[model samples]
Target: MNAPGHVLVVGASAAGLSTAEALRRKGFGGRLTLIGAEPEPPYDRPPLSKQVLSGAWEPTRAQLRTKEVLDALDAEFLLGDPAAALDVERRSVSTASGTTVSADAVVVATGITARTLPGQSGLRGVHVVRTVADSLALRSALLKARRVVVVGDGVLGAETAATARLMGLEVCVVGPQPAPMTGQLGPFVAGHLAALHTGNGVGLRTGVLLDALLSQDGAVTGVRLSDGEEVAADVVVAAIGCSPCTDWLAGSGLDLDDGVVCDAHCRAAEGVWAVGDVARWHHQGLGRLLRLENRTNATEQALAVAGNILGEDRPYLPVPYFWSDQFDVRLQVFGVPSAENTVEVVEGDPAEGRFVVRYDGPRGPVGVLGWRMPKQARLHRAGLVDHYTQPLEPTAP
Candidate 1:
């Protein structure tokens, strides 16, 4: 296929910016237009819950690229205007501002929005961290809050609780999981994380279902749990999860499930490719459609999509890596971590807060997790392919 004359990227964050930059690096001298819902330029999101929330870094410091670097890309940036519709047949995208932009190829990298709890809308002192503005607002609230209750036990939740505690706020984290980040790090490693949070003066309440958010005159007061217990909170931060930003493509005739469904090459249709958190592409190794929301996957997948857009028919096969920092621990993971997998200590000691653990599936070791042992994790990551290809053992019902 010939190189497209023009490419339209429907996001301005890491994935979109990476795709545009990769296209230029791949020698595609085409017209590139990057559109974003936020007025801000491309910025890093991983530090929002940590540095930004803790008042250690300003929001501008999270920029993915400087103005000089962005200008060097020579791409048109349409900021603050969100795409409302995609006319795939006409090869055009209509924004909320009622302007239609035509392109030879389109890269959907809209990413996702933070998921909110039920009855959370229009409530004061209730926050969900996703964008820079979200972090700024929550940071301001934390300064004035006395007690903060963070819902969910994912990476964002754990990070938020840590930040809140750092700001001297009495912090309590509530989640339905057995341990914080259990879904990603598994139970054994997550137990150590739970101890870490507790050691740092943060409360942890696990395996409890949140029934509703109790409010007093349009302001959040506390949360009611399924066990009929109420936890008083001056502020509530819901770090449950995020949903893909795919509502704009509702009737675009493209496959849309949890995200923009795509093939192994990240192609949704002819001239249409999806990347980043908004894309759920088929993983050749896992044999399933997987959507990764981490910063690494966003940039890595964008590069793959860019190459495919330039007529390189390569399948994207990644080792799947993500990391999180909370209190004094730095947790790094490679490959898929499943609860069904048997975990074994590979190196170091979990109690000492410097260790490496491997997740062994029915066939063999499928994942490697490191706590302050990134070097060891990288070493074990290369062996994931061999384990992934091994035949699975039969399981009892």
Candidate 2:
């Protein structure tokens, strides 16, 4: 509570590193220990599915903290060792390597792992892009395959399909959702994305269930849909998304909903805080606990938690910004635009590869989504950060 006797951070990803920095910036010059499951130091993950998988970038290229920052902050870095369990009563944690650590305050930012297809483990040419290892595996498979089948239409899946297309590997995307990014950008914007991917030589099939993998000699060869339709493929990638890495928190007494349930200030329980995908934090605007698996949510919550630890009263309210790079088009969204609402096409055109869509709820101006027109998306993000309670003044009635 009082600048923390010692700060222990679990997970050396964006959220963990950001928390350490936020604490130091606020003059919390106490002991800082950061641990991660990966062998590498704290790094960014947004590029893992894009440039890193495309072979144009490396994981270290996405590092959020430099060696100087780590040293100056007096933070201990524990690489290749994951925090296995929390000893809440003792204010300590047990690591996978049998290491124990105790602190006055602990931040849990373990995040989530990729979800794979049901019967994909035995198949040789199957991959899921969530970590550096996953990206490397998928890249290798893409290089050797003549054709690839991608399941799920989330951000990572679409990006993988786009990367495969860039590498000249024919790709087909199968998803039950009507459009890509439907949960964030809403269905109207997602419908336009469906057209974009379809027009780009990537077969976009919506409302289909990718049930099973067809294999020959324990290697992936094709996929069978729930509709009894079989698709030929040299490789299959299941990007159905992620599951929170909170299995170890079972019976820990911390509220565990979809993730480690926390308050607006990122407080999980008595002496713990939750940040990133591992946190189900209360969003005042949405009036519910939200577990956002994105860089934006992770970084913001980390800062909020650090500040709160240092006796700050500011509650974290993220503006909600996310973007995706598929082929050459960049889709950006800024707000919680419910997919069930009516949409008003604002500017640009999806057919021309650039546009902005405004989601209209019963009260009006629920959210905004855009593709290619980055400047437009930025304007919407500014509105959100500025907390635009009402729609912008309409001109000339």
Residue 168 CA error for candidate 2 (Å)?
A: 0.5
Clashing residue pairs in candidate 2 (N, C-alpha, C atoms within 3 angstroms): none
Best by lDDT: 1
lDDT of model 2 at residue 63?
72
- In order of appearance, the predictions have TM-scores of 0.97, 0.94
183-291: candidate 2 lDDT, tens digit per residue: 7667777777777788789987778888789999998889988888898999888889899888877777788878899987889877799898899987766556778
The superposed Cα distance between candidate 1 and the true structure at residue 381, in angstroms, equals 1.2
Cα-based lDDT at residue 68, candidate 1 = 99
